[model samples]
Target: KEEERLRNVDVIRRNGRALGQIIDDILDLSKVEAGKISIEHIDFDLSELLGDIFLLFSRKAQEKGIQFSIESTTSVPSRLVSDPTRIRQILINMVSNALKFTHEGSLRVIFHWKYETTDQFPRSGLLTFQIIDTGVGINDVHQERLFQPFTQAEDSIARQFGGTGLGLVLSRQLAKLLGGNVDLEWSEPGKGSCFRVTIEAVDSAESSQSVPHFLLSETKSASSEDEIVMTLDGIRILLAEDAPDNQLLITHILESSGAEVEVVGNGRDAVDHALAGRYHLVLMDVQMPILSGHEASQELRSRGYCGPIVALTAHAMVEERQRSHDLGYDDYLTKPIDSLKLIQTIRLHAKDQDDVKRENFVATKFSSIDSLS
Candidate 1:
C-alpha cells in the first residue's frame, strides 16, 4: 500500500509538471503573437541537449514498439551560440507532433550544417534540424496553413489528436527568430513527412559550459540511496500573491524543491514583510490589491533592496514585462507557474549578485508565414 501510494504521488507530480508546461507553451504562443517573446542567445552544448531529448523519448518509442534514433554529422559543432531553449522546444514540438500521427513506425532525427553567408553575420552556418517520421503525412492542401497559429491539418485530425495546434506554429516562429525558417522537404499521403528547419549558428570553442538546470541526469550513480537527488535546500523564498488558489499552487511548487517559503496576500504586505525579513528571492505576482507588483518592486528598489525579485505575469504582454524590468524585478514567469521552470528561474536569479538579466528582446524582421510561400 505504501509503495502504491508513492507511485501515485510520482505519477501526479509528473502529470502536473506536464500540464504546467502545456500552459506555459500556450502563453508563449500568445507572447509570440504579441511580439513579446525574446530570443535568448546563450552558449550551450547543442549535441548534449539532443542526446537528452533522445533519452527522454526512448521509453515512449519502446512502449509503442516504434523505432527511434538520432544522427548528426561531425560538421555540426559540439557547442553552439544561440537560444538553446527555443531550439530544444522546436525539436520537441516536431517530434511530439510526429508521434501523434504515427501509430506503428519509425522516427529519426538528423542534424547537420550548411555553409551560408548572411548580410549581418558572414561566417555563420545554417544548422539544419531534420525530423523524418513514418507518420500519416500532411496532405498538400492542408499544408498551406500548417504553421498558422491555432491551426491543425483538419477538423477530423484535430478531434482525433486533441491539440491547440500551436506547436508547429511556435516552432516555425522560433526558428525564424533565430534567422532561419522551416521548410517542407518532402511528403506523401501514405509514405511519410520530412520537415527541415534551418537556423543561423556559430560554433563555440569552449566545451564545458553551463547547461539548463532541468536538463539533469536521470539518476545519481555516485550518491547513496537515501540521498536527495535535487533540491533548493537552505533557500528562503517570499511569495507575494493575492489569489488563494495561485498562492497554494505556487507554495506547493516551491516547497517541493526544498525551499522554505512564506506568503503574503497583497503587494503592500510584500513590501513590508520583505523589508522586515531576509529572503534569497521573491516571487511577486504582478497584479495585487492596494499596490501592484510593479509598485511594490519600485518601493523595494527605492529602499535599496538589491536581492533577486521575479514577477509572476498573467498577460505575457510586452508592456507588463517591460514594467517588471523597469520597476526592478530581475526576471519573470507567466502565471499557472511551471514547476521546473519556476525552480530553475529561482536558482538562476538566486546566484546573481550582479545585474545580469535575460538579454534584451531582439525582434526579427522576417515572418514565419513568409517562409511558407
Candidate 2:
C-alpha cells in the first residue's frame, strides 16, 4: 500500500507539474485582471528582500557554474513601503531565465537608482530597478511579444528550457500593479539582456521599513536570538488538497507556522471536515476529482460552514477567482505556494473569520429576540 501510494504520488507529481504551469499563467492573469493585487506600502528592507532573492537564485546559478552577481546602489533605500514579494518574484524569474539560457559566462544583476521621466506621463520622475544579465539575449523581432502571456522567444527556447513563458508576463503585470513597468532595455544575441523595472519612489518617511523588528528584545543577547522562536505557534488549520505531494508540502509549511493541520484530499471532503471539525480556517483546493472546490464550497454554504475558506489553485485568472469568491470562498492563494504569502493569507483570513463570527453571532442573537414577537 505504501509503494502504491508512492506510485500514485509520482503520477500526481507529473500531472501537477504540467497543470501547475498552466495554473501559474491563469493565476497571474487572474490577479491582474481581477485587480486583486494592490500596492501595499509597508516598511521593509529593500536590501534584505534583494539579498533573499540573491540567495534564492545563487543556487541555480551555481548549478550551471554561471557567476551570479548583485550590485546595489548606495542610494537604494534600505527600508521602503512597497511590495517586496512581487519584486523578488520578478527578479527571480528574470534571473532564472537568464541562467537557463546562458550556457557560458557570468550573469550580473546591478541595481542603481535612476530618476527618469516617461513619455507616457511627462514630468513624472521614477526610480528604476535594473536587472542586467550576461546570457542568451532575446532577438529584436520577439521583443514585443516577450511580455505577452505564455509566449517565449521561440518554440525552441521553450523546448530547450522547460518553462511556461508566463514569467515575463507575470513580472510585467506585477510591475504595473505597483504603478511601474518592466522594460527590456537591451537584448543582444550571444551577449545578454537588460530589463529595467521602474516605480514611483516612496519618500524616506514612507520608506522607514524594518525587517521583523518586533522579535528583538531590550534585554536579549545574540545567544537568546537563536533560542527565541521566530515562527507563529499553535495555529489550527484545515488544508484541502487532492494531490498527496502538494498536501505534504502545504502541511510542512503550515507546520513551520507552528500550526496543527488536518488535511483532506478534495473539496467535498474539505467542506465535510470543515463543517464537522473544529478548525481555525480552511485551505480549499479549487480543482479536485471527487468534487470541485467551488461545488464543495457551495455545499459548505448551504450547510452553514461559515469559517474562512481560502481557495488554493494553479489558475491565476480573474474570472476563476471571482467565481471562487462568488462561491463563498473567503480568500485565494495561487500556486507555486509562496511560504510567506501563505502565512500572511492565514493571518488575514483568521482575522476576517473572527470578524465574521462576531457579526454572525450578534445577528443570530438579535433574530432570537425578534422571534419572541
Candidate 3:
C-alpha cells in the first residue's frame, strides 16, 4: 500500500494541479463578488510587470501567428506605486480574450498618454493602454453589456469564446482597484475590438536594484534521491487536514524531507496549534468541523499570522479558490493532494529563507552538492 501510494504521486500531482488552478480562479471571483477583494499598493516597475505578462502570453500569440506588441510613449511613467498583480491580471484577461476571438488579424498593445488639456502637459500623465485585435468585434448593442458581471454578448459568443464572461468585469473592477477604469473605445463587428484603460501615473523614481526573476520552473522530474536532497529540510510546516489517511500521507512526505510536521484535525485545532507553534508554513483545509477553514484563516489573519497560510480544499472551483484568498489565505490547494506541489507551494513562500540557507550551505563544506548532477 505504501509503495502504491508513492507510485501514484505522479497522477495525483497532475490531477491536483489542474484542480488547484480551477479552485484559484473560482476563489478569485468569489472574493470579487463578495466585495472582499483587497489591493496592496507597492512601488513596482511597469516594464517588468508588462514583460512578465507578455512573456506569459507570447507562446499563445505565436501559436496564432498574431502580432503582440507593447508600446510606451515618452510621457508614460516607467515606475509607479500600484497594484502590480491586479494590473497584470487585467492585462492577461484582456489579451487572452482578444486572442481567442481574433483568428485572422494582428493583436497590438499600445501604451501612451491620454492628454487632459492641449496646453497643460501635466507631470503625471494619464497612462492609457489600448488592446486592438483583428478579429470578430462586438456590436454597438452588446458593447454596453460586455463589462457586466456574468453576461457576455451572446450565448453563442460566450460558448464559442469559452470563458465565464467574468474577465472584462473583473478587469474593470481591478482597474477600479488601481484607481482607474476600463472603457470601450471602439469596436466594429467582424473587424476587431479596442479597449482603452486609463490610469494615473506618478513620476518615475530611480529604479530599485532589480531583484532576480522568480523562477517558476517545472518540477515534474526528479529521482527520489534528488527530491529528498532538495525538499524542505528546515522549515516547520503546520498541516491542518481532517482526513486521517491524508494527514498520514502528507506527514510521511514532509517528514521524509526532514521538515518538522505538525498535524491537526480541524480548523479550531489548527489555529490553536498554529498560535502555539513556531511554524514556517500552514497547510489549511478549507472545510473542517468546529470552525471552517475560512473562519480559522480569518482568525489567524486578525491575530497577525504573518507566515504563509496555504488553503487546502476538496472543492476545486473558481468560487472556492477566490473565497480562500478573500479569507486571507496566501495560496491554495485541493484534495488528493500532490505531495510535491504541497512542498512546492510551501517552498515558494519560504523561498527567501531557503535561499539564505542554500547560499550558506553552498559557501560551507557542503558546497560539493551545489554542482551535483
lDDT (CA) per prediction = 0.72, 0.66, 0.68
Model 3 per-residue lDDT tens digits across residues 1-373:
9889987996776556656544555667777777776666555567666765565555566566566666654445556655666777778778878888987657777776543433433434466778888989999888888977668888798666556677787778778766688888899998998998867554445553322222112222222233213367777888898889888998998898778888999999998988777777789888889988889999988987666678887865546656676787777766667665566556546643435233122111111100110
lDDT score, candidate 2: 0.66
Write model 1 residue lDDT over 102-174, tens digit each, in one string: 7777888777766575776565677887889888888889888787777888888877776767888888888
**C-alpha root-mean-square deviation, candidate 3:** 10.4
Residue pairs clashing, model 1? none
When sorted by lDDT, best at the front, the candidate numbers are 1, 3, 2
- lDDT by residue for model 2 (169-210), tens: 887887887778888999998788888887654434544433
Query: Which structure is stronger by TM-score: 2 or 3?
Result: 2
Report the number of clashing residue pairs per model.
0, 10, 9
TM per candidate comes to 0.65, 0.57, 0.55
- lDDT measured at residue 306 in model 1 versus the true structure, 0 to 100: 68
TM-score result, candidate 1: 0.65
Question: Model 1 off-target regions past 4 Å?
Answer: 1-71, 75-79, 103-108, 114-123, 139-145, 148-151, 188-192, 204-236, 257-260, 268-281, 289-291, 299-307, 338-373
Off by over 4 Å in 3: 1-30, 113-125, 204-373
